[model samples]
Target: MVRLPLTPAEVARGQRLGALLRRARGERSMLDIALDAHVSPETLRKIESGRVATPAFPTIAAIADVLGLSLDAVWAEISRPEHDVTPAASAHTRPERLTA
Candidate 1:
């Protein structure tokens, strides 16, 4: 399968997703979260570090569930904003933190 290169917008969104998941993780160990999410620690690490710019949906959903983030919130965090809103710009705004 040929995978196209990610656009700048996609890269930006992936970074935002990583940051949001990291914040929601708070004080938890990455290993613990990764194990609970049924993903390898390295996989989680890559996602959190934005090395995997466009991860599979199931992978993200599992990680988000482990972090107690709603899909809607995840979308809001990573999706491009319309009108005057910018996803990166919105990242500057504080979001509700999640706890284990």
Candidate 2:
């Protein structure tokens, strides 16, 4: 299935997510994590560089599993601000439908 297009906000969030993951991966070669997650090192590199903005859930689950991160926590951390009531929330604020 074709993945939905990401809005500017989502792109920014993906960049932030990449940054966080990169930070968390300090000292560990990308190859190591890629091997552990059963993904290609290039895939990990794309993810960390925000080249692949919306990775599959199973792919993310695998990466998170290797990083010892919770799916909920990952979602919470990357959600857009409008999805939540908090002043600085990060919920998925964009509309679900695609615009022309």
RMSD to the true structure for each prediction, in A, is: 5.6, 8.8
TM-score of each: 0.79, 0.71
What lDDT tens digits, residue by residue, belong to model 2 across residues 1-100? 9967889987877876676567667788899999999999998899899998777778777876677665655676667464543322322232343222
RMSD of 1: 5.6
Query: lDDT per residue, candidate 1, 1-100, as tens digits?
Result: 9988999888877888888888888899999999999999999999899989798988887888778776667787788553424444343333465332
Clashes of 2: 4
Clashes of each: 0, 4
**TM-score, candidate number 2:** 0.71
Which candidate achieves the best TM-score against the true structure? Answer: 1
